[model samples]
Target: MSHIHIPDGVMPIWFVLAGWAATAVILYFCMRRVRDVELGRKIPLIGIVSALMILGMTLDIIPIAYHINMSVIAGIVLGPALGFISIFIVDLIISMFGHGGVTVVGLNTLIVGTEAMLGFYFFRVFLGVFGAGRLSPGMSAALAAVLSLIISTCLMIGVVYISQINPERVLHVHKENPLGKIFSLEPEGENKRHKIEDKRIDIETFAKTVFSLGVFGWILEGVITGFVIRYVSRVRPDLVLSEVT
Candidate 1:
């Protein structure tokens, strides 16, 4: 839901370069942090998680143009370093398909990877707090995923604000509401209520519209994340809890 699909030449070149450099540094640290033996053991799981993320991103919600990321699921199962690495792989592969375009892959990774990291950390925090209360794994995960997505969504909006991108060019999504062609989701005609037509849109307007739509995606993904985590915990506690810490 928080993925940025801005094509090349849209974002400031300096911002794009900075994004790549930051992503590279994070990747390096993550590589250094993961042990060689551990890396070998987790390679298959990493591939599985990355594939799930990629697959989840392809399905848009009925009317919101939002898609699930399964990123929190990655963090819950794989731990932060591995999860970020997995997200990088997902972003790279998706960029090839123009999900966010090749030039914005770095930025996309940073945003979604932050979501994954926050998911892991917030899960840990909530686990500690809710453990005494006996909160179900599914419930804890749901809460964590929702909160992580909210923060990541804000971060994404911040990027667009800083880059001075208009809403139309932000995610570049288009849809025809089936309820009636009474309106389209293209940010055109009557749908101008959702976006600005000028080169530099009002950040407040963009943020408001995005959050209104993003809340649905966030909660839905959170539910999915929670259920997946619960299932994994039931079958392989070692994978979700033991190794993540």
Candidate 2:
């Protein structure tokens, strides 16, 4: 529910490149951490988690209008470092199949990775603070899912405002492209696209739209994640918490 689907050519190059670089750095650290652990038995479990994430993403229970991503559940079960790597791998595989543009891979990785890490850490914290025995696994999973969506949404809103709404930057691009003809500074007598450009998107509008449509799906994701995590915790609690100290 938190993944960005801005499509190609919409986001600025700088934002995309920055996202890519950050993802690369995070992945490097994650790999180093995993290698240092020497958890040979967990390797197959990691692979299974990655495969499940890919399948979850590809299945799409809801249509495109409600874009749902189950990466948060993976993160909650897999821990942050492993979750980030798993999501990165899943996104890479999906990109090859043309599910999403290559240029946006970095952004996608960041968005989904953010969801995974937040869910994992928060769930751990929640369990530690409240005592896992006090709450059902389902509840923990749901909370983690909600936190993941909230964090991911904030990141995406920042990306959109920085890349799409800055007048100095957007104006420069408008002046250079054929899209300029369709979009202009004129207040009246302009086409629909031009009118949209004249208004410009502000943070409030961006937040409202993103959150309004997102909250329901996010809650639903939270419930599912909570149920799954709870089930896993009951069956194998060590599997979920062993890697992350």
Off by over 4 Å in 2: 65-67, 165-203
Clashing residue pairs found in predicted model 1: none
Find the 10 residues in a row with the least total lDDT in model 2. 184-193
Cα lDDT of model 1 by residue, 1-245, tens digit: 68886777566555777789999999999888885545667999999899988888887767455789999989888889989999999999988887887988889999999999999988888888778343477788899999999999999999887776554544443333453243222223334334545656678887898899888888898888888888887888888785652
> What would the TM-scores of all predictions be?
0.83, 0.80
RMSD after CA superposition, every candidate:
9.8, 5.6
RMSD of 2: 5.6
Sequence-dependent TM-score of model 1: 0.83
Question: Would you give me the overall lDDT of model 2?
Answer: 0.73
Q: List the residue pairs that clash in candidate 2.
A: 1-69, 141-226, 142-226
